[model samples]
Target: MTLKVTDLCIARGGIPVLTGVNFTLAPGAALILRGPNGSGKTTLLRTLAGLQPPLGGRIEAPPESLVYAGHADGIKQVLSVAENLTFWARVFGRRDIDAALAAFELAPLADRAAGTLSAGQKRRLGLARLLVTGRPVWLLDEPTVSLDAHATALFAAAVRAHLAEGGSALIATHIDLGLAEAAALDVAPLRARAPAPDDFDGVFA
Candidate 1:
């Protein structure tokens, strides 16, 4: 199944953040969302991930078919790296954790407390979580936020492989992710007024 958005509009309060946003992504395709700060990059990604409601739009996604990996990573700081990945693996019913960790170069930090790992290390662990799940769709917001060149390359390779396997990705990032044959969507022009307090209804509307 493909992910599609039609006539999507997002407002923070009463201010408009996104207007008439529309796009469709098929399996094995990747879309790189390029936008400056406050341009609704995160907002659109969140909306597509089903974390937020669109002000006026329609979305189609299958149950448990999509995964979101944002800057926060959705990680448990209290758990060790391995424990964190294990939790996700169990949640997603994945059979292999070591392979995922190794793929992300997180084997060494597997037992380290997530709170103790450096930013880049934590990000890598987050990617590992995504890999273990083997989900078909990925909604990544700044996935490479804290990664170095090497780690970034690793992430790129993994994403490429995911696409090769017929998985789709919609990534919001300010930098290049090195995805081959990926299309770029610019969201900067969609920015407008901030949503108003009363406009909160639009978020769920």
Candidate 2:
């Protein structure tokens, strides 16, 4: 599936943060989003993922084709690693999790309680869920937060594999995944202007 965003505007806390945004993520391609800390990268990703509505403009893609991974690992601390993957797979209507475990090298930790794992291990586990989601588009925010160089390479490999199979990714990260299919976009220039004196963003339609 291809995702197209045209003249997109996104906001945070009811205040416009990014405007005039545009991009297309073709099948088998990845787009790396770059901007300063306060930039609207997260907002943009959230908007694209349909977690929040865009303030204006368009985002076109097949329905239910996107999955998002944010800064938090989004794991179940009480569950075993394998159980967690199984849980997500079932939720997404998938039944097998073997590929997810092997992709992130989480098989060794499969029976371990997620809470007992180190930060990097938790991160790997969190990313492993992507494999089971079965969605064609991935929206990742700071995906490599707790990973070491080796683990980062593992993630890059997984992404390459996903792309090789026609998946698309929109990643918001500082680390270079070294993907040849990567394209970079800087969103600083699109930061929104101060709200107008008469602007009624929260109160009006």
Candidate 3:
């Protein structure tokens, strides 16, 4: 699967955040989005994931082939770690949880309630869902937020394996994920300039 973006523009709170972004990602490749806070890295990822509409431009990728993991872990606190994975697998019409469990090293904590797990453990459970989804394109936002170095290594390994199997990822993060071959895009240049005070006053007045 391939994802192509052309002249994309994104907005937050009805104000433009980024404009004129373009990229094409092919299978077995990854793209890392880099930018300071409020630079629209998350906005771009959200737009690409179909979580929000783009102000302008085009994104060409099959809806079914994309899976997005945002800043939130998206785990049900009441459910056990294994149960959460099972639920997602069923939602995606799959029946395997072994790979997801082993991928994030959650096998030992499989039976533990998500609410009882530490922040890092919950994050792992959340990431484990990606493998179970069986999607070809991954849109991840700060996926390693609470993970330690060892867990980060595990995350990198999972991503590497996915790319090796012809899957692609677009990650928005601040730290290195060890995906050296991945293309990088710095969103700083794409940030939209705020309207001048006079322009805003004229419009409001």
Model 2 scores a TM of 0.95
lDDT measured at residue 164 in model 3 versus the true structure, 0 to 100 = 99
TM-score, every prediction: 0.89, 0.95, 0.96
Whichever of 1 and 2 has more TM-score, that candidate is 2
Off by over 4 Å in 2: 196-205
Per-candidate clash tally: 6, 0, 0
TM-score (C-alpha, index-matched) for candidate 1: 0.89
**Model 1 ranges off by over 4 Å:** 192-205
Better of 2 and 3 by lDDT: 3
lDDT of each: 0.84, 0.92, 0.93
lDDT value, residue 26 of candidate 2: 97
Q: What does each candidate score in C-alpha RMSD?
A: 2.9, 1.7, 2.0
Which structure among the candidates has the greatest lDDT?
3
Model 3 residue 58 lDDT score: 94
Q: Write the per-residue lDDT of candidate 2 for residues 7-96, one digit (tens) a residue.
A: 998889888899999999999999999999989999998888888998899999976899999988889999999999999999999989
Writing each residue's lDDT as its tens digit, candidate 1 over 83-182 gives 9988988898876788778878888888899999898988898888888887899999999998999999999988898888999999988787767689
Lowest lDDT block of 10, candidate 1: 195-204
